[model samples]
Target: MPTPNQAALDFLLNRRSRPAKTLTTPVPNRAELETILTAAARTPDHGKLEPWRFIVLEKPALNRLAALVDQRGNDLGIDPDKITKANAQFATADLVVAVISAPVDSPKVPQIEQVYSAGAVCLALVNAGLAAGWGANWLSGWASHDRAFVTEGLGLAEHEHVAGFIHLGTEKNAPPERPRPDLAAITTWVDA
Candidate 1:
């Protein structure tokens, strides 16, 4: 017989991500954020290749990013509505952790595996923030995928990419539970 951790299971089952727009000020401070980040860094990293890094973006940095989003959107001739939404993502954010997927060169570990690790880190970060009593949401927009924007704004290397931008703050509103996938429909029992 195995002892089950009910608290952990309960949290996992009931956890909900607050929308980025619904997040507000009073985010975690440096020391508090360090604890949350430490939890996030404990994710699985096969081959010991830490294929991810975190960049904490404060209000000033976010403002800069918001401006850059506008510039990049204009330069790329993106839809005006898209630019406004993307700009608001950064402009209104008080705190965000930019998960950078920096895949290491390893013959044993495939690049795809490294990318997956980075994505896992993003999820871990969001979960960590939520566990720490902060509203958290994982976000990625057109600016995150734009090479020029990442290069100029975030100073990402050629091999690095934006895994996700985790917004963290106080929750303004509690969103109603949305529909969840049916596990039975997606499950496959392969007994070969």
Candidate 2:
């Protein structure tokens, strides 16, 4: 039988993401955020490609991005409500770590795997923050996929894109636990 850490399992089972909107000030300091990022760096990487990087955003950067989002939305003729919603994330975030999916050129490791690794890093960062007693949430909106926004706003290269924005801060209020997916309905048993 495989050994299991009960505490870790319990934490995995009960861990819930706090809404970014509910996050407040008194965010993690540089040293603390670095510790969390270090923990996140342990995500699985195929071919050792290390196909991701983190961009820490403070108030100024976040505000600039929010303005960029508004401009891009207007340029693209996007819905006002949607643009407002997306802008709010950057406008209100106490701190954000933008995970960039920068896939490395690897003969053995496929591009999809590299992208998945980047996504893993995002989740790891969020979980690490929550474990460290901070409120964290992973968010990506339409602007993430917009070429103009990704290129000009975040300065992502052609081969790179935003996997997610990990928002971290103190929780202003406890969020109610939402209903979970039906595991039995989603699970499939493969038997010979």
CA lDDT, every model vs. true structure? 0.96, 0.95
Which lDDT tens digits does candidate 2 get at residues 1-192?
999999888888999999999998999999999999999999999988889999999999999999999999999999999999999999999799999999988889999999999999999999999999999999999999999998988889999999999999999998999999999999999998
Model 1 lDDT tens row, 1-192 = 999999988999999999999999999999999999999999999999999999999999999999999999999999999999999999999999999999999999999999999999999999999999999999999999999999998999999999999999999999899999999999999999
- Where is model 1 more than 4 Å wrong at Cα? none
For candidate 2, report its TM-score: 0.97
Top of the candidates by TM-score: 1
Question: In candidate 2, where is summed lDDT lowest over 10 consecutive residues?
Answer: 147-156
RMSD of 2: 0.9
TM-score of each: 0.99, 0.97
- Output the worst ten-in-a-row residue range by lDDT, candidate 1: 2-11
Backbone steric clashes in candidate 1, count? 0
